[model samples]
Target: MARIKNGILGGVQGCIGDVEGFIRNGEAFIRKRKKKSTVPRSVKQLANMQKMSVIGEMIHSMTSFVALGFELISKNQSFSANNAAKSYQLKHSLQGQYPNLNIDYAQVRLSEGQLPVAVNPIVNLMDNGVQFSWEIDADQSYDRATPRVMLLVYAPALKKSYYTLSGARKNAGTDFMELPDSFKGHELHAYISFITDDKNEISNSAYVGSIGPAFIEGRNEAEDSFKAQNDDHKDVLTTKSIEHKDLLIPAIITIDDIKPEKVVHTKPNDRFDKRAKAVMKRIKK
Candidate 1:
């Protein structure tokens, strides 16, 4: 609303259409309004929104660790660590179409820096916990040993993840992430990285292999579908209104819906085929 201070042609006091009015040094001034795009969102824009939604939700589950993981990378930047990592994941980690996107856990990175990454990383399921071990690089410097291992374990079905910002030292060669009793029967994905003791520097996270079943999300739903078809002759079928006994009416269909002639081909979903084969090799005894 722009109010005319004087009769008809004086100073404007508020906003009008694409401009705003203000009084500076007792002088009336108007500023042009910033324009907003009125066009419909493009296909790519919608796809990015879907990606952001999926990644944002997952990252929120482990925000504390994620924030610290990219702390240094986000230093002095406009965005926070969480957004930095999210931006990175949005570009490289997500897979599949708009509504059916999934995170490529193997390519997902928690931290980024110049420090050395975990080498020969291995994960194993044992005693209600997952063990993380890596071949430590032979850099005996204090900086190398000062870097501690950071670990993450994610349970997709549960949509919950647990991580250690600072766990075992890089030289420890092994670390264990104890899972709660609830994690026992679930499939898991693990990632590992290294951060300095002072949390100043970090290494790129490595995919520490997955254990348990390579369960496909949402596959647990009932494979077979049932559609009930029933027809009625309206209210005229009632005993009181049965004057049209000569008329043909549809019979109420009560069927089990299973066809004896129909055959369902159960395609093998064995660890997503050859991909799971390679992941299986990463499993250490």
Candidate 2:
């Protein structure tokens, strides 16, 4: 009887401990739920989260190798660090002459607190080519002193791409590019980017949607032949051949003399005379 009473006490103690633990966890959860955020997370803030951290880590790792190379080159007799610095400046100077914007993120900032202006391109389909136009007034985010446009056109079916550069001022209204006949019936996609003259900063690419020639049904040679031969008959028709060789075109036959299916032995003088008399009456009238 004493052992049974001890067992009951042990069960009661275990239930009390579990109840206390549950109460503490519930209170902590309630406290967390009561905490309020000052501002809701914005799209840009969410996107920028960990962006700088990853970029800084990548730059740090790359700079270590680049710095070591530069130090070793500084000690070398053939190429010094001063020479490398001058070479780098010269290379960028040459690049400045051209609208050289390969990667979109590589674009440098123009001024303090300035970012690339988003551009909306108007893609037009022409009879023989395609045209691109954008409203310069819409780009009010950054100051564009001298603007350069990069147009990229791609044909997925043809697996071909064409890109060109145009000055925003020169092509004020619209810019046209002639497409090849092979681009017919294939979908073409276009993207446009702008570069600033002072900073050579490239803007984010704006997808202009699919722009290309209209879909045209090309003539199928095999279908054409089959349709022509089987138009009015159910029998499978074969191309005419002289012997066993297939001919592109059948030979034409011309006969000078005509033969009737059944020749009548009756005299033709009576009919000829009646036709002559009728002709004379009409002429006299």
Candidate with best lDDT: 1
Predicted candidate 2 versus true structure: per-residue lDDT over 1-74, tens digit per residue: 01222354322211232232112211211112234569987756654433433233322322322232233334
Regions more than 4 Å wrong, model 1 = 1-42, 214-285
User: Candidate 2 — which residues are off by over 4 angstroms?
Assistant: 1-115, 138-145, 170-173, 197-199, 212-285
Prediction 1 global C-alpha lDDT: 0.74
Top candidate, metric TM-score? 1
TM-score, candidate number 2: 0.34
RMSD for each of the candidates: 21.1, 23.9
**lDDT tens digits, residue span 100-217, model 1:** 8989988888878888899899998775578899996676687787688899988887888978887988888999988776666777889998988777788888988788653333
Q: Cα lDDT for residue 19, model 1?
A: 89
lDDT of 2 at 176: 73
Q: What lDDT does the true structure give each of the candidates?
A: 0.74, 0.44
